[model samples]
Target chain A: MKKIMNAPDAFVAESLEGLVRAHEGLVTFGAGRTFIRRRDLAPGKVAVISGGGAGHEPLHSGFVGRGMLDAACTGHVFTSPTPDQIVAAMDETDTGAGCLLVVKNYDGDVMNFEMAAEMAASRHAIDTVIVEDDAATGPSLRSRGRRGIAGTVVVEKILGAAAEQGSNLAALKTLGDDLNRRIRSMGVALRGTTVPENARETFSLGPDEMEIGVGIHGEPGLERTRFAGANEIIRLLGERILAEFPSDVAEGGTARPLLIVNGFGGTPPIELYLAQGIAHRFFENHGVVPARTLTGTFVTSLDMAGLSITLALLDEVQFKLWCAPVATPCLSW
Target chain B: MKKIMNAPDAFVAESLEGLVRAHEGLVTFGAGRTFIRRRDLAPGKVAVISGGGAGHEPLHSGFVGRGMLDAACTGHVFTSPTPDQIVAAMDETDTGAGCLLVVKNYDGDVMNFEMAAEMAASRHAIDTVIVEDDAATGPSLRSRGRRGIAGTVVVEKILGAAAEQGSNLAALKTLGDDLNRRIRSMGVALRGTTVPENARETFSLGPDEMEIGVGIHGEPGLERTRFAGANEIIRLLGERILAEFPSDVAEGGTARPLLIVNGFGGTPPIELYLAQGIAHRFFENHGVVPARTLTGTFVTSLDMAGLSITLALLDEVQFKLWCAPVATPCLSW
Candidate 1:
């Protein structure tokens, strides 16, 4: 493969090493050598830690800094972090207050983080908040509940802000869960992803086709539709997200929703801003004017040509929390 | 041809429209509609304006904010802005102190910017500092000299800070030229770029090969070689940059160099950070520890799969300028 990595097995460690080295003042490695923790933790503040696969970068890892995530545990490419890694993160950031795990809705992630919370319960009071805001999938007990995607970033930002204000672990968990319910994200892929270890692409598409609602792991989406113009494609994705979004804050002009136009690695910034424009206009016409729009490759799918749109309905409290300043490697606002 | 654009001919305008809409508080379009000027210009401060082809985004337009470029004139993709566009930027930003045009080392750009400065001479004082920091090129006068790449960001940043500090037009120009001389940048492409208007890739490589010293516009470079491990390839690129780098600051520990690992759009953030780690260790061995390493897709080639490393020997004066606060749409420090 043409990946710029030394070896497939060393991807996680090498990547983390580069990250910690590049951001020496903000983050550093923990005892386990996998998870990252803030170099200087806030005294008596609830530690908000999150982790998952390694490929979707700047998510859990890049968000570690002063006002965001206190620590982040990373696993192998597309693999969930082990319980030991989670507990280590808890130990690194937990002061006398407590620790909160911001887990995604993946089966492995949820289960592993749960075990880690139980394992660290004696040392630190622990709580769990699972982000399951991917509205592309239906919520049914039979199916693996709605898989968390880009909306996890919204949850983390709000929860991290709440925790930074000295909210207790249980309070932060409640905020995270409520914020997760108010956010929805959906992805569209013009091309599929490939694992660094594999020498071939995991999936391929026709010359003029895209996968709407594709998962971060190259999972199949709601449909493999024909390629369309930018406006049409954005409308399709936005409609799907809006359809399943809760009515309690559907036309959220009260506090004004936050919209994020995230690129999946390969898409250019020019296009992401274009997508943000289409999203803003479309939503404005639908009686929802976003208070803020973030456009970047904060969440990615390796180096694939794709993008995801996230809509977070913020109340007065959540809106204030969203406006809180964060100084991280990937995000600065 | 899978770009998220409505029409090929409308690429530049649509992209700029989206950019202006997304960052309404920071920048807006000028009279000619091809240039962008800051929303609230600092009174009596020297205005720094930069522009070139449109595709290398976040270069000119993204830097148009509070403490960066006062104005940015954009042209069609890979095409230089016309004299009219440059004149419009000059008139819009030059508030008695004077205007500085930061042009790249391209024939079309230099010619057009010179014409614009001459045309606007009677109205405002305009000086120019052309950046030619691409080390892959030889300094043969006949040969187009060196094409400016990611190092343009360094020039803009330093000059922008200098301008903000009330440096006169001539002083800012001198700083810009000196900063250009102190910096050297080289790019390696795992894959080539494609113009959206064109339906095919501009250049292609063998399955196991890469293009070292590739230009931002898919220009051929010094060598097309086999792809190697990250460490070895970083060494190759780093050595080339260091070799052509000046002897005055060859072992610059006194003022500490600033190293930038810039992505060519298509490379993921994880790989870029990995390259930064390699660059840091590699430069440390070479007796230079960078005062700061800003790694990101600051300047890009329309989502091409590649990256460039920029090394700048910053004297104490310039080091302070480099560390000055900057708040822009794409860059913040």
Candidate 2:
């Protein structure tokens, strides 16, 4: 695989080093470079932390700054961070108002974050909010329920704002849980990502076939389908997400959805914007006017050519929190 | 050529439609969707307008909003917009303070923008600032001197803020010219982008070879070499750019450079951040501290897997202008 790196094994560490160096004013590395924390953490505020694999950049690390995440523990590409790393993040970010851990619903991630919370409970108040917003995985197939995907960004944004407003640990956890249940995401991948250590694509597909409902980590998608136009792909993803929305949010026609057209690393912004437009029109035709829309590469796999559509049913308070000002490396408004 | 497009020929128009719809509150399309302008155009401020080929997104179009370009005209992929479109942008954006056209130094772009300036001269005051910062082609190679590349983003950011601060058209033109002359850039491409109309990659390369000094529109680069590590590639590009710096900016060692590690669409954020680290060290080793560094996919060539380095020597005033607040769909600060 062609990639810009010094050594395959050192890719994640070196990239993290580069990130800290590039945004020195906004973030800093922890004791062992296993976690990153905001440079200026406010006292008496609930600390919000999140992490997963390293490939989905601007997710955990990039969100660590003012009005967002207080810290993030990072793992190697498509791998979970160790419990020790999660503890490091918690120790560095807890400001007495307590700490909130936003963990994606992956087996490894859930276990590690839970262990970290147990480890940190003696010294500081810590709580975990598990996010499982992916609609592609049915309830019967997996005991872990749906895997968290791009909707994690929405959860992070809302919870980050709520935490910054001096919300206690329990309040922030409740907010995160509520938002996670309201959000749903699904993706389509045209190509697979190449992990540096493996030096090979995670999967392969026919030239005219696409993996619908693909996971961010190149997990097996629901099915292989014929390649089609943007509108069709968007419609399929939208229909699945809308079908699974809570009946109160879906049936009453009073749902004010917040749309996120997330690019899966290698997709260009032009196509993402086009997808956003298609998704917006589709929602409008179905009698829903989105309250807010965010279109960019918020979450990604390593050089994967695909995208995900996320819809979060928003209440007035949640919508207000989503619109709250944020200052981070990847997101600032 | 796998792309998220409705139809090959409809790509540009449809993409623009999506852009306008996605940023409905911030921007609006001119007559016939030929140009996009900020909705809240301030009267009596110099209007900065920029455009070129359509493929390099988030460049001209994404830069339109507060503290940036007042309007942008888009052409087909890798093709220049017509004079009529440029005229339309000028007519819609020009206030009492006149208008400034920021055109890259491509043959078609320069010619078309020049013709549009002449056409619009009958009604409104219009001036043009040509950007030619690429150091790949020597002065003697082509009459056009050098091709404009990613440095155009830097120019727009500075000039956009200057215009917002009520700089007149003449002053904005001079500032753009000064900054263009001081800036130098070089790029490397791992893959060629596929133009929508062509339905084929612009060029091909051996699996282990990379094109250095590649142009935004997939123009041939200076050389094809075996792929190397990130540090080596960055050092090579940095050396070329630093070597071509004007005597004043290079000799005194007092120059505060603004660095832009721009992704060519397909390169992930991890690689770009790593590149930024290497570039930062390269400059520091040479006894220069970058006053400001912006790293992201600001300028891009569709889905080309590569990146470019732009170093613009900055005076205190220009650096301040660069930090000014601006909000747009793709960019916010």
- Which 10-residue window of candidate 1 chain B scores lowest in summed lDDT? B245-254
Among all candidates shown, the one with the greatest DockQ: 2
What shift in Å separates residue B199 of candidate 2 from its native position after superposition?
Answer: 0.8
- Per-residue accuracy of model 2 over A145-261 as CA lDDT, tens digit each: 889999998899899999888788889888888887789999999888889988878889888989999998889999899998998998889899988776766775545689889
Model 1 per-residue lDDT tens digits across residues A111-158: 899999889989998888888888788686327679889988888888
Model 2 interface CAPRI class: medium
> Residue A178 lDDT in model 1?
80
Give every collision pair in model 1: none
Per-residue error (Å), model 2, residue B298: 1.5
Backbone clash total for model 1 is 0
